[model samples]
Target: MRLGRVFSVIAVCFFVSACSWFGGDEKRLPDIPEQQLYDEAITALEQQEYETAVEKLQMLEARYPFGRYSEQAQLELIFAYHKNFEPEAARAAADRFIRLHPSHENIDYAYYLKGLTAFEQDQSMFQRFLPIDIDQRDPGAARSSFESFSTLINRYPDSSYAPDAQKRMLFLKNRLASYEVHVANYYMKRGAYIAAANRGRYVVENLKETPATPDALAVMYQAYELLGEQQLAQSARDVLLANYPNYPLKSYKVKNTSLLETATFGLFGSESEADDPPRPTTEDKQGLEKPENEAQKEQETKRPWYHKATFGIFE
Candidate 1:
């Protein structure tokens, strides 16, 4: 009796599922009607109905997998997602198109769409422009955009989008270099001279082709000198000279501490001419100080008048 009851229950469940699948007034997914489905999807996309367009384009892809408009549908769907601010979906569609049709006539546009998706996926202005948060350092989205755009540039140098991609690439490149320089300057301001020098060195080594090269080299020279790395400072100076001969490295002033200290102390005492181990003087000493030493003594004797008056003492 229990087995019969179990069989009856199973039969009822299967019957309900079948009914729902075929008889519950659910619109049967239509067959791929070549141009009609494609046109409908395009219309949906044009009407800004991205979800509906995606549904239709997905049906077209499934039903007419190798149809003439299959790739076009896929590409348009990417644009639809992008237009709707659905960056992830757009990126996925673009990637799928590229994987499936690497050499498609519209492959450049596909890659460009990937870059656009990446660019759009970035955070808003508050996160990017505000100094209160670390969102400014979030390089993942920006780097992806740059890399995708760079790929397009390298692969399709003659593509119509090449110029735009190149411009974006330069902007991203400069942004990254500026980030490095900011860090270096931070270290410099904190008196972390070695750290600042190292950061600048990394830029010169890795980002020589960038606009930040000259600034990086200049900062590095200053940092090296501050850290007393004279050799490295000289090397940086040479690089600056070689790249920018008229930049005037000599104009950058650095103090001579030793000379400064000596000059500060020397004003208190006059140099003794006879202190040089009794150099033969024109006048005989006669057990007295030599003439040069006497001359210095006489000059020293005057005490510049100001010193004797202030200290109330004589030499």
Candidate 2:
């Protein structure tokens, strides 16, 4: 009986091996029609299902690299990658499309999208929700964005996207200028006068027409003054005064912030001199007081209960 069972097992093993070696009829998945695949991707895009759209578009490209809709698919893939939060992939796709179809009618749009990808790369979820200083962040992406927009405008001056590209380029230019001013401000607080002055000079010379020009001038003046370069300091100060009359030197910050104050989001204390709220003028106080009687005026002038208890901190 044992011998018979061993023989049956051996026969079963051989049958399995034979089936694996010589295949029976196996069903194949039908190739999706090119038009159908493109339509599905477009539908997903219209529905704002960018992840699905990206998958479909990728599949379409892999299956139909030279199909009628290949070029349009490539363009839509760039947008889909951007919408799906794949900035690097979006930029790669944009560059590839631009290289492949240099004379394409929509080449300008490709450049525009490429610039926009880098333009928004620094804006994170925290920046969207918190009160973060955008100018204090990295400026590499901003510079790249500016260059891409510049290329688009220079190469395709009459393209339909040139107007919006121009606007974005201006925004990037100002942003880059402000970033330089912020760095210079930091260097000033660190007592690195030469570095601060260099950054300020850069903004003044190359990044004109920006709101930060006044701040840059202020930094340069302060830095030169601290370094005992009286002539250079006066030159910077004169230009600042000529352009922005009545500017307060005390309004600029060149001080260090305590760790506790910085960690508490300036709730413990603030280092910024420019952020002080305007004090109420004497005329403004008198306008609020009624002339009913001396007692009534005195009562009105009294602080609120919580304000007095907290020594005016709560108020």
Q: What is the C-alpha lDDT of each candidate?
A: 0.78, 0.87
Candidate 1 has its poorest 10 consecutive residues by lDDT at: 251-260
Positional deviation of 157 in candidate 1, in angstroms? 1.1
- In model 2, the Cα lDDT at residue 218 comes to 92
Model 1, position 244: C-alpha lDDT score: 81
Q: Which stretches of candidate 2 lie over 4 Å from their true place?
A: 1-29, 250-315
Global lDDT of model 2? 0.87
Q: What is the lDDT of residue 136 in candidate 1?
A: 36
Q: What tens-digit string does per-residue lDDT give for candidate 2 at 80-135?
A: 99999999999999999999999999989999999999988866788899999899
Q: Give the RMSD in angstroms, all C-alphas superposed, for model 2.
A: 11.6
Which residue pairs overlap in candidate 2's backbone?
Answer: none
